[model samples]
Target: MAILITGGAGYLGSHTAVRLLEKENDVIVMDNFTRSSAEQINRITAAAGRAPEVEDGDVKTKEDLERVFQKYNVEAVIHFAGLKAAGESVEKPLLYYRENLQMTLCLLEIMEDYQVKKLIFSSSAAVYGNCESMPVSESTPKNPINPYGHSKAMIEQMLEDIAQADPAWQITALRYFNPVGAHPSIAVGENPAGTPANLMPILLEAAAGERDAVDVYGTDYDTKDGTGIRDYIHVMDLADGHIAAAASQKHGFHVYNLGTGRGTTVLELINMVERVSGKHIAWEAKARRPGDPAENWADASRAERELGWKASCTLEEMCLHAWKWKEEMHKNTQKGE
Candidate 1:
């Protein structure tokens, strides 16, 4: 039996693919090279020391999904195929809803047809938009404020309904916090095709002199140091959480927050990057972005108790690894790698 990773060329998907490959599982990567590239599959191979069979296709197309299901003995799926920028989703709500929802619906239909019920969804902490508490739990009322978060919450509800109706399906939705850093190999990291929407990448850009300065969004959000606080877990740890969810013996649908229980402020993140990269990162305070919360961490005890998974990397290690990856990418670019 093989595991089919939709969007396996993406940042989170590629890291998860590497982890799965290291475990000696047959991994078939299906991607259309939209936000990622075919060369990412090669990097996955270099990182894991094993190659995954690549299928060039989009998840929105049923024919493409059906072909993969027919071609492989796909026993499980780790779904990471979706547009993930909250700001972009805000600007293009219709596109986000159509593409994100359509792709999942198509993938689910194909899974049902193939009788392959095991799935691990790539969810996000954005679903817990502006929670009333610190350290949001699985039971927190999913009151998503943005179109992107709404898409994720909608999919989680859909999965719950499907699992409730059928006892044969095993689905787990992992609500990830900010997944920063990269794999230790530095071969596979978060390198988006166009502009990056995440924090770490933008910070690295400013540190590398690729940009003028990092925009400190919302410096008066009632957080310590007057900046927003978030749970920034390393990308590798997030990848391992998917592996644990796949290995879980539990039946029925479930949701787990893949994050460190601690929170870090935006200012602290900037300082850490500067300290690690040995460069001064200039920043300018800006007005708060709409729908951004003051504090958002995770209550990850359930994942530990149920899936035997917990984040192990520290913030310092996260910054160090990400800096190393950025430096390596620069050298490769200069050397024409």
Candidate 2:
């Protein structure tokens, strides 16, 4: 029985694939390689000493998914294939919906056709748009402020509806907090195609001279340092949470918050990265982007109680591993040049 992972070559997807492979699970990776790469599979192979079968295809194209279903003995799926940028999604709402929601619908249809019942959907905390309280719980209201979050919320509801209709469908949506950092090996991690978006990556890119300077979005928000504060969980910890969710005994539609249950401000995170990487990073303050929140962290108690998992990595560890990967990638690029 193979676990099919959509967008298995992506940042979070690839990390989850590595963990699944390490657990001795037969894995099938389906990706379009638009915002990913086949080399990610190579890194997975190196890390786990085993790699998933790669299907170079898109989920929106039902034919590609059909080919994978027919070829492999898929038992469960972890869907992560989609455009994930909230800021970009604000500019192109239709594009986000067309790719994320439509592809999810196609995957669900194919899974039903193939009689695959188990699914673990990758979700985001943005669904709880600007929660009035701190440490948002799983019961947080679904008030997405942007197109990207709305797309995720819609799919989550669709999964809920499906679960209600069928009792046997095992589904769990892991609403992830800010997923940062890289694999410790420096062999596999995010491969930025251009300028990075997230804080950790952008900070690392600046340290490695890949970018001019990191832009601090929203410098006055009434937080520790007036910058946006978020729960920055390491990618590996998030991957482990997915594994726990997949292996859980619980059934029906469920939601779990995978986070460190702590908030770190932007300036605080930048300081940690600088301290860990030993690089005097340069940064500039910029206005708050649309759909941005002042402060948001997770009340991940549900995941701990249900999945028997919690993020254990420290902030320094996250910064250290991320910098290692960034430096290694920069060295590789220099060699290529």
Which is the leading candidate under TM-score?
A: 1
Give the residue spans of candidate 2 off by over 4 A: none
Clashing pairs in 1: none
Poorest stretch of ten by lDDT in candidate 1: 190-199
Q: Write the per-residue lDDT of candidate 1 for residues 1-337, one digit (tens) a residue.
A: 9999999999999999999999999999999989898889989999999999999999999999989999999999999999998989999999999989999999999999999999999999888888988779999989888899999999999999999999999999999999999899888888866788888999998888788998888887777799999999999999999999999977799999999999999999999999999999999999988767888999998999999999999999999999999988878887898
Each model's C-alpha lDDT? 0.92, 0.90
Top-lDDT structure, candidate number: 1
- Compute the lDDT for candidate 1: 0.92
Candidate 2 residue 72 Cα shift, in angstroms, is 1.2
Candidate 2 colliding pairs, count: 0
Q: Per-residue CA lDDT of candidate 2, range 120-180, in tens?
A: 9999998899999988999878899999999999999999999899988999999999888
Candidate 1 ranges with C-alpha deviation above 4 Å: none
TM-score of 2: 0.97
